[model samples]
Target: ELKAHSEFRFESNTSLQLVLKRGTAEIFGTELAIDIPYNFNGVKLAVYTYHGAALEITGETIVEYTSEETPMPIYYNLHLALEQRRMLKKSPRILLIGSGRNTASKILANYAVRMGRSPLYIDLDVTNGSTLFPGTMNAFVLDKVVNVEEGCPSSTPLSYFYGQTSISTNMRLYKKIIAKMATVLYKKLEQDEALMDAGMIIIAPKWSDSVGFEILQHIIEAYQVTVVAVLGNERLYSEIIKKNKNEGVEVLKVPKSGGVIDRDVIYRRQEMSRQINRYFYKVDNEFTPYSLILNYKDVSVKKISEEFVAPTSALPIGATRIVDDIRVVDVEPSSAMNHMILALSACEQTEDEEAIAISNVFGYMCVTEIDDAKQRMTLLVPCYGKLPKPYILVGNMKWIDHQ
Candidate 1:
């Protein structure tokens, strides 16, 4: 089952079943548990054993006998460095920045847990629904090892509603939300000594090539980022280094995995829907979401982009709105937001725009059935008939329930 310095690599067409039967082995720098059968398929992963040992391999899978080099060890070294800093009581807040799906923030966060650090993992990618779910900004402290097969458990993460996928759709609102989330995180760090000392690890938003640079700089300042981990982009690395004028901030370029594939829009949307459903109902189908019917007048369903006054129109001497010169596509809740996800806001109906922007969300609801005739909308809520808050915000996000 095992040999000295032996490597077992799997092919895309086959699933591998490896049970660590003997001495010692590691996959992607994380040690394999003895007698545990790990199932992996269509992934670029390797099982390596030092000084021999192994037991069972039973699966209809092709073993790829290729000599491919990966930079996973280099990333492990970065984790080691951060772990060292944490041990010495110097808090380090790391932010992983890149454009696309290839950014291996997930893997890095897993590695940090493997190295025994309770890093506060923040996911800013609302598009793909990687960490918690789509249309959410989430934070979870990694106190234990993460599962390779599934996302971080729903109970583990504290999620906030961002209400939409793309940052470009509402740039002004997105910046405000991010800053607010950072403030919340700092407050959390103050209470939890271990997580605070271990510091923050953020999976940066998926930024476009043109506007990504400026947004990256904004996030750097927002989080007071100690380290900016740039993945696979030379131009971004150079630009970040040049733009980062802050002292003691290190900009490091990390390699992207060759196995990372780009997901299309439809695929991402489907994934997002699955994530939402999973939050309300687990994969086993035993859980049922509450069906609530609420009158339109009872809840505030105004779009974040709804401008009472046009941006170009003349305003009073000292009056300014959040939407001035900011590009935001308004979502008409009564008509356009049918089948869309709505975030229940903690902010009151009379709260200011900035207040609503930073307010915490209680839970999410799918505008399942809207009846304009009766002025009522049916919502699929997580709990049983309990509306935590009366104010809900709608975005330009919709879910097509295939079920």
Candidate 2:
């Protein structure tokens, strides 16, 4: 004699779409498919038989199965329960870092809310308090905020990926602070084995790039958790290709021109989050419109003139192309020089004396025609004095095509 039983458990309201198979004993089976409603937990499958002479429920046949449900609160609960069963367990700590904006912070916060988890949000680059606490109306709460001092000693090593400068130096310090914070937070989460088992360490940089990517690498090494990178910039995407050429870092890049808060993007994320919630107890939601905004053609350069004279004071010593409608000149590093150049470039020559005085202090100057073309001007500053490598800066005006 043999006896077999199958049991199914439904954690959420879900309908099982099934196709039944016929058995040799002439046991009839019916196929059913339906959408299980939400919040309906637990269900079972049983087998019964009816014959001409006898009606009977045969060999214990109960199948316990679980439906795929969003992992948010439920996942956290399950994780907590599982941790309690283990003698030694640790909950991982998550750190979400983004550019000094509330977009990334809010998205991550929403994910935490759905998962019944609390997260810490830090605004590393807050020029104004606007993007900080009490952010935009749509911003997410339930996460702590930490504002990094503008000028502080860095705790992490500096990255020379981009040209070295005072700003880059400060960025290194910011990275260190984040790494230290991650370590401290991880230790705290590890205190309770149950919490540890239920905890996860996550860090979502505002966007990936030379600076952001480096910061992400630092955080990954510091906490050693799974990384879900949300790329917003093409530069950042390039960095991922170069860095993780062969490594497995689970980098997710939103399609080009994809805005962070666009309706389509939000819907796509909602569906993705729902699925992730079903599979993982914790999910990270950090999307930004960096790429979309960067790719927008809304802003264009406009020309202010066809032929104009550049203020003499704005011309560099070696600049000989004076007759040319537009002349690009290199200048020495001087506050006065920069101010004068900016003024001359803007065609505000009433302050020409002051501009000249500033120009004398700086090593070079240039004067160009005042026209709509000037609006699209780009200044290329060489890395070395009179060297070939140049760093380009677009003028403050929009480009207008003369078609």
Candidate 3:
């Protein structure tokens, strides 16, 4: 690995005649000579490999040369020169989306700041009542705030059996509130163009909602901005890819095994802090080109995982199923388990008072299920109404059978 010119010296016992040829041969400058004998006992002959890859011997005899200096290692100097070039090309704009959990966002933010760009943190979730969003705001208060709207509710009622109710109406109200808030936030940015000039950073949560998708679409369509980078969950990243494959977006998902975001805000804060430290302290100034080269490595590896992992494959298992007797009112957002229960309960016929009482207590219920030893049956329970078929079988039993 180390290449340099070295001088070889030897004192022979006899006046030995040696031919120094190229590659185990004797040579005198450009001439292929025969035996070259040492006349004196201490007489020295200079042997060197010149630019033509030919071995040459100086005709002048050496008497008492004390010290010899060789050229410095060339590779080390070459590497240093390359590093200097990389440092000159480091850009400042980067958009990092994370789970608000780990160090990914923090690292990127720190990198931006150290590189002379103030990081902007835009929280994607408008409903989750967590301090993570506010914490991000506090950390990067001068940055842009992009509040993404959570999309419309699912088109099914399955809460009654699970003891929950519909949240459609409430979600609609929440959406309006988010839109108003976003407009206000955008207005603030417009009023201060300086802040806008610093560019925007979108810190999005997992993109499992229509709202997140819509927000990204809107931003790409409206703004004349370049998305320098993306960092987030694989699922969310896939959604982004599906939507913008042709846009040449660069997404970087932290490895699942290597301290990535996982819905924990404290972890996220710590990770972000560490990233800031690394970016400012550890990463070399020559990291930009290397990072760019490895940018697609993570994305490609994640894509491979998605293709081979059956569990990760997208499925329509949660899609709405037909309820013969049950009348689905309005769609709403709820936890996945709650949604399943409500869907099963919506197949039964119930009295108006009883339905209202159940709705009052549980929010909204549209399905019911009765489990037997051999089989389980579903009842489509319409809210405050009667269905032609009181019991419409949806699917075979599983939980009851296992029990």
Candidate 4:
């Protein structure tokens, strides 16, 4: 038995099981079923309850405690307001921007889902993406509730490979990718009225510069964001309100949950490793990925050009040409390919730089080993037999499979 309006927070590096033995509780906004064990691994989360409840736990934890301090009521009130706005508007794009965006994003997503709304969770936090692996900007339609263990659905996500974890690597490409997503999403909303009605919940990339506000303005204009919720930042709230005063956007300042934990670079890297591992093996070893070997001639390995400029189509054929800050140039097989994550592009034509940049990733594979002399590389992919595309893009993204 526990007091109402409290939170049960824990940090676990290994496997752990949680059960709501009595009364009701929730992780984020998704309600937990009574007497069901939810397995978690390498996750730090808080199970919050508005009323008294009893929770049973099994397995090891780095830390565990109950907190009387919380901001659930404030969050709930914001949710209720947003819910009203959602009801009146055909689609209200809600963007959550702040330092503690990940936790806030999860809480808002859970709240929306419980109200029987299917919202799109857009992850711009390339440093720690929730929909796909870190370094990829993705959007997943949370049409169905996720299992507590699963956290977020990975079956299919609208993902774009930025090739780097931080937007600072290619700031120009970052803005372009956002532009492309907006274009793609507009088309999608036109076709799927349900998704339009469901709207979107976007978690912006971690930004703390003048350019950040410009990017936010660009997104607001591109996506027509109706709500901008700034968590734990009164300055940001005031700034956003001042900037978008003429735009008629609702900007709210919400308190960050006291239980939200700060994740350092080391912690983020470890989580990224786990996320990559999960991509291949899944949470419960539900999928067994196949290892495939290929010669240099088998597939085309390409990387973005170092030179950045406006797109040009006047360049010679079969040679790397600049296109919208990036150009696909063929890369020779070398030791550099080892442990690198290559995005499998949906666009088969390797010469189409524009198409490749905007096209959604079909899948991703890791280069586990490279034989320089033989010009052969080993790949660990989710594909069982044959890969659909021959165009693979390499970026700064790399992951060492601990297994």
Every model's TM-score: 0.81, 0.30, 0.30, 0.92
For model 4, what is the C-alpha lDDT against the true structure?
A: 0.81
Expressed as tens digits, the lDDT of each residue in 1-403 for candidate 1 is 5557665655444555668888987664457788988775434455656666665766665445422455555666788888888888788888887643223555566677776677887787777657767778877787765555334433456666776777776666677777888888888888988887787788888868766777777778888889988887898789778878878889998876544446677656556766666667755455787789988777667456622335645666677644463322334347556788888877766546667666877777888888888988888887886676666777667875544
Full-model lDDT for every candidate: 0.69, 0.29, 0.30, 0.81
lDDT (tens digit, per residue) of candidate 2 on 1-403: 1012221221112333322223211111111112221121111222221211111222232343322221123323433432342324333333333321233333333334334444333333311112211100001123322111111111221111111111233353344444544555566555644344444424343443446666666655665544333334456556665775334345543321111232244443333224222211211223211101111122221111122446677889867546333222333322221211121122222322222211111111111222232332222111123212122112111111111
> What's the lDDT for residue 348 in model 3?
38
The TM-score measured for candidate 2 stands at 0.30
TM-score of 3: 0.30
What is candidate 4's lDDT per residue for 160-195, written digit by digit as tens? 888887777677777788888888888888898777
The candidate, 1 or 2, that scores higher on TM-score is 1
| Top-TM-score structure, candidate number | 4
Put down candidate 3 lDDT per residue, 190-246, tens digits, no spaces: 676444444444443344464556555544443322452344357676766677643
Residue 341's lDDT in candidate 3: 19
Q: What does the lDDT read for residue 321 in candidate 1? A: 46
* lDDT over C-alpha atoms for residue 49 of model 4: 91
Any runs in candidate 4 off by more than 4 Å, and if so which?
Answer: 306-324
